[model samples]
Structures are given as C-alpha cells and as structure tokens.
Target: MLLVPLVYLVIALAQVQAGAYAAQSTAIDAARQAARQPEGAAARAQALGELHFADHGLESARWTVELSCSGDCARAGSRVTAAVEARVPVPGVPQIWGGAHVPGITVRAEHTDVVSPEES
Candidate 1:
C-alpha cells in the first residue's frame, strides 16, 4: 500500500531532476550557440534544435526557448541570453487527458554568453 505511493514519489522526483538538468544544460548550450551566430533568427533556430540533443528524458516538443540580447547580436561584447522552459509530466500519467488536466512540473533555466570579438 504505502510502498506503491513511495515508488511513484521516487519516479516523479527522478523525472523532475532529469528535466531540471536538461533545462539548465540546454539553456547554457543554446546561449553559447546563439552568441556565436551573427543572425538572431538563425541563433534562435539553433538553440531550439539543441533541445533534441539533450540527454535528459525531455520531450523536445514540450520545451520552448526564448532569447534576448544586450545589443546587436553580432556586435562584439554583446551578450546573448537563452531561457529554456519545459513541462515534465509525472510518470504513469496518461496524455490522453489534455495537458491542462495532466499533472506536470515546470522547469526553467537561463544562460548568457558574450559575443566573441573575433566573430564580428
């Protein structure tokens, strides 16, 4: 009886932890990639693509990346910021229920990197 709930609790915690790690790493990698790119649109696309490469058990479709720049993205010394957000579903939850009805935890991370002077 109690054991079942405990097992579920552990599974849920593990999922949350993995999702958090994925969000953080994705944010860092995406920011770095964006900082290296000269175009905002290209940078955003690259950052979004990074989600598919994340090792954690994240569903890329459930994630979003938002970007902001200190100035012209291509300018040396400018900083590019990437914010990643994801909704991780609880294990054993059926998705047939709409997302609004499904239980999930929201995880987010943000990272910033400066544009390299040589890239300008």
Candidate 2:
C-alpha cells in the first residue's frame, strides 16, 4: 500500500518536469517569432500572443515575459532576446488521500534570435 502513494508522488513529479520542458519550448518559440517582427509595440504584442498560444496549462497571470534587443536592433547583425518565467502549480494526488503537499516550481527560458535588416 505504501508503494502506491510513492507511485503517485513519482507520477506527479514527472508531470511537473514535463510541464517545465513544455514551457521552455514555448518561450523559445515566442522569442523566435518576436525576433522576426519589427521593434515596437506590435512586436511585443505578437510575442505575447505567441506565448499565450503556447502556454502549457499554465496560468497566464503567473507568467512573465520580457523582450529586449542589443546592438543595432534594426540591423541584420543585431539580436533580439526573449525571456519567459512562470510558476507552475504541481498537479499532485489529493492530500486527503495521504499525498504529500508539493509546492509549485518556477520555470524559465530565454532565447536570442538574429534580426534581418530587411525586416521592418
């Protein structure tokens, strides 16, 4: 019987790990999409929209996204960076069923993409 609870815990932990991986991938995709857009509010909005679309069962309110550019952003050699952080709630077995109280985990991902001068 004790093994059953342990199994549940292991499964819950695995789910959390998987969620974190998914969030990282989402962030990378958002960054890539944002880098392709012009540097302005429109680009930011586009990135956020991508993040929202790629969210892996995470609460949007708990997610933070940042976009930045270094060097001549409008130039072909410039780079755009996107950072995403989120606190994901762990889906664990019910506590009433003798499950452990597992706190949430924070996951973050950042990606940099080169900008093409021709793109505006």
Candidate 3:
C-alpha cells in the first residue's frame, strides 16, 4: 500500500544522506590535519591525496586544497579549506515510483583555521 512505498523512500533517502555525511567527514578531517602541518604546500598536497570516501554506486573525485597565504608560505600565516565532490546514485526503482529521480547527490566539506605568522 501507500505506507509500504513511504517506508522504502525513507530508507533510500537515509542511505544517500549517510554516504554524503561520511564523505564530508573524511574530507574535513584530512583538511584539518593538513592545516596543522607546517610544511604548507606540501602538506596541502598530502591532504588532497589522502582525502577519500568509498561508495558502492558513487564516484568520488579528488579533493581540492586551498591555502590563504602570500609569498613563500613558509609559515602558517592564513587559513585553509578543502573540498571534495561526490555523485551518489539512487536506484531507478525508487525514482520511478516516487518521481524523485533522486539519481545523484553531491557532498562538499570545508575546514578553516586562523594561522598565525609565527606558527611556522
């Protein structure tokens, strides 16, 4: 009946949401860890490489690392932000019944820091 479809829809939404959150959590954690490193660019690169979340029907892309600094960036003189995008797939069954087409979901994560010049 109608109630049966409602239950299925809720479960599907929950799954996609959970995946999005997991991706965001991983990206944010890696970004924070990278910022805490004094190596600046090198650290950023490492963070980008390390950020990842796995999904069965979702495809994940590489993470982006942003640094707020000028010159050599030898010191932690600014903030940092990292973001990653993911496309989660929703099965066609739910979409056909719900007309949701909930075919894809995107997730992004960001982290900021107050870097001090002397924190080099």
* Per-prediction CA RMSD (Å): 2.7, 5.2, 5.9
Tens-digit lDDT track of model 2 for 1-120: 899889878876775665566656656766676666644734564456455635545442255667777876566767877777766555642445342333567777777888866735
Clashes of 2: 0
For residues 1-120, could you state the per-residue lDDT of candidate 3 as single tens digits? 799889878877875776567566655664565556646544654444444344433333333434443333344555555555555555444556443444565555555544455532
Instruction: Report the lDDT tens digits of candidate 1 across residue range 1-120.
Output: 899999999998998888888778778877888888756644564555455435675553267778789998989899988888878878888878786767788988899899988823
Candidate 3, residue 14: lDDT: 76
Candidates in descending lDDT order: 1, 2, 3
Model 3 quality (TM-score)? 0.56
lDDT (0 to 1) per candidate: 0.76, 0.62, 0.52
The clash number for model 3 is 0
Question: Lowest summed-lDDT stretch of 10 residues in model 3?
Answer: 56-65
Off by over 4 Å in 3: 38-52, 55-74, 92-102, 116-120
Sort by TM-score, top down from the best:
1, 2, 3
